[model samples]
Target: MAARRKPALICCGAALAAAVVLAAVFTALYFTVLRPRPPRVTATVVGTRVSAFALIPSPALNLTFDVAVAAYNPNRAAFEYGEVVTVVRYHGDAVGEAVVPRGEVGARASAEVRAVVEVDAVEVFSSPYFPLEGIAGALPFETATTVAGKAVVLGVLKIRASSVVTCGVTVYPLRKETTSPQCTSTVHVG
Candidate 1:
C-alpha cells in the first residue's frame, strides 16, 4: 500500500510540473508575441477642396480638381517636420513633386502636423500622346498644341521624421487628387 501511494504521488507531481512549465512558456509568448503593435506613422491633409482650372490656353480643357492631405506622426514622441515633398504619381509613374513648405504646422502635444500643398502651373497629362511621364505631362500653356488626356496626381505623402514605434503590417494607401495645374489644393484635416 505504501509503495502504491508513493508511485501515485510521483506521477501527480510530474504532471503538475509539466503544467506549470507550459503555463510559464505560454505567458511569455503572449506578452511578447500577442501584444498589439503601435502605429508608427500616419498621414492626412488639411484645407483640402476643389476648384476649376483655366489658364493661358484659349480653348482650355475643362478640368476641375480636389486637393488635400494631412501628415501625422503615429508615435508617442514629437518629431521635427523636415522637407515635406508631395509627389504626384499617375499610373505608377511620377508626374510631379510639390515641395511643402516647412513650419506648416507641428506640435509635440499632438502627434500631427498640418501640411499645406501649394501647386503652381501643373498640367494634366490625360492624353495618350502626353503620357504622365512625358513632356506633355508638364505641358507648356503658352503652346497652342493640345493633347487631350486623363491623369490623376497621386499624392505620395512622406515626411522626414523619426520614431521608435513599430507599426502593424498594413498598407498606407496613396492619397491623390485630380486637378489641372492651374488649380490648387486647400483641403484640411484634424
Candidate 2:
C-alpha cells in the first residue's frame, strides 16, 4: 500500500508541473504576440482626374482614381494580411470598389497597397444629392472609404482590422488634373 501511494503522489506532481508550464506559455504568448496594439493605417489619392462628361444622349461622367493605402505595423511581430477590399462611397452611395493585393508586413514596417477604381456618372446619379457643379465645375467632393482585411501575428494569432478614411478632393476634367485628397482614418480591431 505504501508503494502504491508513492507512485500516485509522483503522478499528481508531474501533472501539476505540466499544467504550470502550459499556463506560462499561454501567458507569454498573450503578452508578446496576442495583445499587441493594432497597426496604423493611412491613405492618399494619386493620379486621379476627371474625364469629359458624355452628354450626347445623357449626362455621364467618367473618372479614374488611384488611392494608396499604407498599413504601418507597430508591433514586434510581423503582420500577415489577407486580401484587402476597399469600397469608395460618395454621399453614402457606393461609387467604386477595388481589391488590394495581399502581402505580409514585417515587424515595425509599413506596406503600401494601391487600389484603382473607375467611377461613372451612373453611380453618382444614384445618390439622392448629386453635386452637378462638383462634377462639371471645379468643386471639391468627399469620399468615404473603408479598407478591411484579416491580419495575423507570427502567422498564428489572427484578428480583423478595418480602417475608414474620409477624403476631400477635386477633379479637373478640362485640365485633366486633380488635387490630392485630404484623408483621415480611424482603425478598429476585433
Candidate 3:
C-alpha cells in the first residue's frame, strides 16, 4: 500500500509542476505579444477659408472661417471622441470658437471634422501689435483644437486618450486670403 501511494503522490506532483510551467509560459506570451497596446492618433489642420475680415473704422473684425481638421487612428481599435472644441486666437486672446459634435474613427482609419467659426465684433485693439501687422497685410492668428475620447479594443478593453492641436496662420484681410497653416500637436493616453 505504501509503494502504491508513493507512485500516486509523484504523479500528482508532476501534474502540478506541469500546470505551473504552462501558466508561466502563457503569462510571458501575454505580456510580450498578446497584450493590448495603446492607440496612436494624430491631428492636422487641413484647410481654412475666410469669409469676412476687416481692421478698419472701429478696429473690429467680422469674419467667418471654414476650418477642417483630420484625425487619424493607427491601431486595431476604434476611437470614439466625446466632443471637439476649436478656438481661434489673436495675440493669445480668443476671438472665435466652435464646438463639433462627437464622432468616431475606425481602426486604422481617418476622419475629417469641419467647423464654421464666425468672428463677430472681435476687438482688434486689444493687442497693440495688431495694428502693425494689420497694416502690413499679414495678420497672425492661431487655432487650437482639443479632442477627448476613448479607444475600444476588441470590444473589451477601453483606453482613454486625448489630443490637442495648435496651428498658426497668417491672414491678409485686404486680399481675403490666408497662408498655409503650420500645426503642432500633443497626444496623451492612459
Candidate 4:
C-alpha cells in the first residue's frame, strides 16, 4: 500500500509541474505577441533652407530645400528602423529625393533625421500649374515619405512595420522657410 501511494504522489507532482510551465509560456506569449503595440512617428518642418538658380538659355529654375524629420517611439520595446525615403515634389513633379539615416529608437524615445534635397528647374517647370515667372517667390510643394522598420516586443517577438507621411506645404524660397505645412501620417504593422 505504501509503495502504491508513493507512485501516485510522484505522478501528481509531475502533472503540476507541466501545468506551471505551460502557464508561464502562455503569459509570455500574451505580453509579447498577442498584445504587441505599434510605435508612434511624427514629422515637422523645423527648418526649410532653400537655394535657387536659373539657367541662361532655358527658363527652368532649380532649388534646394533642406528639411528636418523627427520620429518618436512610444512602445515599451525598441523600434529599429530600416530605411527612410523622402520624396519632395512641386505641384506634381518630383523635384527632390532624400534617404534618412536608419537607426534604433529606444523604448519611448525620439529620433531626428536630416534630409538635403536638390530640385532641378526643369522638374518644377514641367508642372503645368507651377508659376515659372514667379520662380523667385514662394512655391507650393509636397513631401511624401516612408519609414520601414521592425519593433522588438517584450524582448522576444520582432514585428515588421512601416510609417508613411505626406505633407503639403507652401515654402518661401526667398525666405528659406515653410509656412505651416499640413501633414497626414499612418502606421502599418505586420
Q: State the local distance difference test value for candidate 4.
A: 0.74
Which ranges in model 4 have alpha carbons more than 4 Å from their true place?
Answer: 1-29, 32-35, 53-62, 132-138, 174-177
lDDT of 4 by residue, 90-139 (tens): 77778889887788988778888877777766777676766653565668
Whole-model lDDT, model 2: 0.73
Q: Mark the 10 consecutive residues where model 3 has the least summed lDDT.
A: 34-43
TM-score ranking from best candidate downward: 3, 4, 2, 1
Error of 2 at 91 (Å): 2.1
Scored against the true structure, residue 130 in model 1 reaches a CA lDDT of 38
Give the alpha carbon lDDT tens digit for every residue of 55-163 in model 2.
4566667887887878898776777676666666666567788877677788889889888888856877666555565456553556655666665666677777777
List TM-score per model, in order: 0.31, 0.67, 0.75, 0.75
Clashing pairs in 3: none
- lDDT tens digits, residue span 33-90, model 3: 4454444444444555555556556555556666676777765677788778888888
* Model 2, position 146: C-alpha lDDT score: 63
Q: Model 1 TM-score?
A: 0.31
Candidate 1 lDDT, 27-103, residue by residue in tens: 78645643222223333222333243333343133321122333343322333444445443333334334453443
